[model samples]
Target: MATTNVALQPKRGRPSLARASAIDRVILERARDMFFADGFDAVAMEQVAAAVGISKGTLYARHASKEALFTAVTLDMIAQHSTEAARFDHLLTDDIEQRLRHHARMMVNSLVQPDVRSFQRALSTVQHRFPDLAASISEVGYRYMVRIMRDDIIAAAARDDIPVRDAEGVALMIVSAIGGYQLYETSTGKLTHEELQAHAERTIDIAMAARSSW
Candidate 1:
């Protein structure tokens, strides 16, 4: 048998895997920026490819179409937002009221993020054409927030921080309040830091006042 030079053969290694991941991340981040800046219907894949200095073939190899690209971008945003939310470990403190206020403030803070506001602004524009996509985006956002709120509320109740009546229902209400504020602020216009903070504080304040009576 002919000698096989296996020792000299080039092997696929971790470098290629790292390079692939880096490329994917660059594509997603650049595409996400374009998608957020311009509505999904408005952005072209070719434009994203150009922006990222990649050929259409390379872009297509990563994402089939604009809609597919949008899905990837949206999923990445969701995951990132969850990661950001998870880092707020201070909210699990013994001070129940402070925790609730901090959560609301954090929600408000996210609402003002360039990515979050941009994504919400595109909802009305893209929803008619891609109803399912729009709905999925909204549903995923709501469910994530609700789950976080529910957990926090339960924790607060367990610590006797807040009255433990209907924790799930209260959590949903809190999420609705925050979500509603976010929607309004994004669609209407920019809310100054002062204004955003005031709204967040007031929202939690009112909700807490109600819980006191319940």
Candidate 2:
């Protein structure tokens, strides 16, 4: 019997951990867009796989199902927000109003974002089906926003810029006012960037003035 020469090939199965994570990042990016546009009840796993340019099997290897993918996408957003807040957490300047304006602008950016608006719509539509997930995101996102604002409030008051006694309450007022104003502006007619900035500045002024009584 003659031994035949055999070609050796790299075994193809699942990706390595790092590769899988990279692939999952892409999948979640696609999933976020799809879920934002179509909502949880409307988006299908197959659609996400195709959109992500991956096979259903490959996608499933990363996420067990659409719900799992959605959860991952939500978590990804949460992580990104946390990272951004941390990135600028130490930016305490002499201008408390200016800092508040900056925070207001960040809130405005989030509230006025088309993708965020779509995501909010999607969440509201499907929250009934995923009550726990809805509650989780709502609580987490709200607290994250509040925490960001509260930290800034405390910093500014410590610097004697705002003289806010109730840092936590003042932060809530400032954040909510900016967010609510943006939401209103977006729903009515979109405000120009300049107009929104002006509005935010005015709101920050009012919030700081209200702190005088505190």
Candidate 3:
């Protein structure tokens, strides 16, 4: 019989590590909410930790600095969006108009989230101060938006309902249309949220209709 020397078993702390990471994520999300509402310059790391019912030392252990935390928060926001978008992607139907409508509704839902709206405003305020933060936001948020839209268009083409000539280009055009509508609301005047949703649906419908020549 081979002498199985089960020498001093190393401590297995994987569960503890996982639990700690989960706590850190919760802290980061709470901190992100406070920072967005109060502005990054006004918020402190201690305050963030306190908001999450954690100690500043614990927060620091997870995130080396305020800047790092801020960056992580932005990345988290993008991750949340991607998760939401994936849900919509799975709900895609054979009806092109219905799919467009669903997408429009989901977009409105995302924009109307209090935290998301605050995050966008906060980003606009400090993007100039931290270039890396701004770049990360751009790559995660903006770039992800473009890629998701493009992929959705491709899927629509495969479904054979939406006659898209060039799925990628058409996706960009759809994005541009939706973006223009959003800009009008943000800049010009107070458009009812319902009106914005309706406008987005119609705009998307018209754009998809243009691909009749598929």
In order of appearance, the predictions have TM-scores of 0.78, 0.76, 0.74
Task: Estimate every model's Cα lDDT from 0 to 1.
Answer: 0.73, 0.70, 0.70
Please report how far candidate 2 places residue 54 from its true position, in Å.
3.8
1 or 2, greater by lDDT:
1
User: Top TM-score: which candidate number?
Assistant: 1
Q: After TM-score superposition, what is the CA distance of residue 127 in candidate 1 from its true location, in Å?
A: 2.6
Off by over 4 Å in 2: 1-11, 53-57, 81-91, 155-165
Worst 10-residue lDDT window, candidate 3: 1-10
Error of 3 at 87 (Å): 3.4
Candidate 1 at residue 202, lDDT? 82
Q: Across residues 49-118, which tens digit of lDDT does each residue of candidate 2 receive?
A: 7766667887898788777788788878877765665576467566767777777766665555556667
Candidate 3 residue lDDT tens string, 1-214: 1121122122354336656666766766677767877898898888877666656786798899988999998888778876876775777776766766676676666665657667867777888989998988877765555576677667867876545667667666666676667755765546567877887788777876776753
Superposed by TM-score, candidate 1 places the C-alpha of residue 30 at a distance from the truth, in angstroms, of: 1.7
Candidate 3 Cα outliers beyond 4 Å, as residue runs: 1-15, 53-55, 95-97, 155-166, 187-189, 212-214
Supply every candidate's count of residue pairs whose N, Cα or C atoms clash at under 3 angstroms. 0, 0, 0
What does the lDDT come to for candidate 1? Answer: 0.73
